[model samples]
Target: MRQTWRWFGPRDLVSIDAVRQAGAEGIVTALHHVPTGTVWSPAEIEQRKREIATMKDGSPSTLTWDVVESLPVSEDIKKQSGDWRAHIAAYKQSLRNLSDAGIGVICYNFMPVLDWTRTDLAWRLPTGGTCMRFDLTDFAAFDIFILERPGADADFPEEVRAAASARLAGMDGARQERLARNVVFGLPGAAESFTLEDVRRHLAEYAPLGADGLRANMAAFLEEVAPLAQELGLRLCCHPDDPPFSLLGLPRIMSTEADYTWLINAVDLPANGITLCSGSLGARPDNDLPGMMKRLGDRVHFLHLRNVRRETAGIPCSFHEAEHLGGGTDMVALVRAALAEEARRRVAGRADASIPFRPDHGQDILDDLGRQAQPGYPSIGRLKGLAELRGIIAAETHAG
Candidate 1:
């Protein structure tokens, strides 16, 4: 695996020097300044690349930008409404431009109405600094009582709804506001934020599009773009649903293995692939992480490694930032499967044998919280994760 770190470009608090200090050679980033549905010109791509490449003293660092975390998909395209064809065309052109600049992997998600959901952004950790976590109760509280979207209460069981209402009743105005912002305010690279009215409007747009409708829209979008992906030697990897389930009555299309099968078969293209996110899918007990990795190994172009702590019946599952080798995933089996796939690719003389992976979400520990950066992408936690993964991979190689 080639280690990479997600950077939000020049405006990001985490500098290139900090990324290098974290032990990653590749940077996964995007042109955040550019709005959605616009073409990313080659000049813009190269300019961002050069900016990251050049060091403080005007010398170049070996660090290279190899992947784009996402090139935002316009809501118009996802809804497949009027003028979406133009947006789709522009999206393909962006892929062409990115490929021309040698970016081969693009990570994106197809969750309707939201990206990753978190109840608390600065959840206190035992290590002192905070980490991102999702609590079912917190979300239920939001859905049933806070946002008070029509029909939201019906989404949860009666007991859960009662608990949610109670929780919301206890929360003060400021705490409730923070919870709402954390859930809907859109993390830097995850999704775009919308005002309360804007969210309600977006929900209205998807009201006509159910699970099947959203799936169809995704397939149509891929059908138009996958061919270009193949042409440009790019692997388009769709990230799995964050909670691996529906939220606020919005459909989640890429939550399970069946969804992945549906997507690849719908497009019928080799360039279409999966960005295996362990923590997201692992939130659900039914998903077999190692099995999914083994089954989809041939098509997985990137990996987001993290872990979540699953709870028993009444308890809510909280996402803890775990070491790569100590997480909920069967790290050894996953590593073995990934390595086997890489070996097979090498045997076949495939050029894309080295897949790029990064530690998805990290604990906000040490000096990372002191400095301002993306919430979940703290330097020390990720550096620890990368080092753990590297050691595991190295040990596996030696054992072989």
Candidate 2:
């Protein structure tokens, strides 16, 4: 695997130098300032390339922008609604610009409304560190009592509804407000965030689509762009829905192995691929990380290696970020599977022989407790995760 780190931009609390110090061979980033539906100019892309190329001290940062963590799939495109055609055209142009600049991979997700949902950004762990968490009762409390999404109570089970009521009752106005913010203010280091009203409006628009409609829209999108991605020599991968379940009564199309299989077969081309994020998929107990890697290895373009411990034994249950190697997913075995995939790809003489992977979310510890960079992207925490993942890769390589 080709080790990479996600950098927000010049404004990121984690600097390019820090990423180099963490031993990342490549940088994963996007043109975040560019609005979702706008086309990216080569000049803007080159400016970012220059930013990642050298530090303020006129020194080489020893990094190259390898993968776009996302080139945002706009709401218009997702719903095939207002300006949907224009957004698709802009997306295609952006792909051309990215490929022209030598980027090989692009990661995107089709989840509606919010990209990811979490009730707590800094949930304290037993080790005295803090990690992000998604509490079922807490999320339900926000969904039903706080955000007040219509018919939200019916979506959850009776026990969850009761627990959520109890949870909401215990909280004061300030706690309720914080929970709302945490859920809405998800996307780490984005230029802007959505207000609660914004979320409500989006939900209202999506209510009529349901699951099958949403999946069809996503398939239509792939049909348009996947072929262009193949022509441009770019690998376009869809990130699995975070938490791998429904939220705010919205449909979750890409959350399981079956969803990914459907997604890869949607366009049925080399550019149509999957971004195998273990932390997101591992939130569901049934997702076999290593097994999926082995079966879907051919179409897996990017990897997010992190884990979460499910608070309960069911779908839509609570989960908290765990250590990269200590969480529910078997990190060692997953790494070995990725290595085996790389070997096969090399043998097949593929261009994307080595998969680019970033150590995903990490618990806040050490100086990270004070630095407080991005919610799940504390510097020292991710560095520790990268070191552990690197060790596993090393052991797997030597053994092979």
Residue 147 C-alpha lDDT in model 1: 78
Structural similarity to truth (TM-score) of each candidate: 0.96, 0.99
Cα lDDT of model 1 by residue, 143-251, tens digit: 7677778898778878778878888889999988889888885748543567767778888889889998888889888888998898888999999998787888898
Error of 2 at 34 (Å): 1.2
Model 2 ranges off by over 4 Å? none
Provide the global lDDT of candidate 2 against the true structure: 0.92
- The TM-score of predicted model 2 comes to 0.99
- Model 2 over residues 1-400: C-alpha lDDT tens digits? 9999999999899999899889999999998888889998999999999999997788999799999978888888889899999999999999999999999899999999898989999999988999999999999999999888889989999999999999999999999999999999856766568999999999999989999999999999999999999999999999999989999999999999999999988889989999999999999998999999999999999999998998898888899999999889999989999999999999999989999999998999999999989899999999999999999988877844
lDDT for 69 (candidate 2) = 79
| lDDT score for candidate 1 against the true structure | 0.82
Model 1 misplaced stretches (Cα beyond 4 Å): 189-191, 312-321
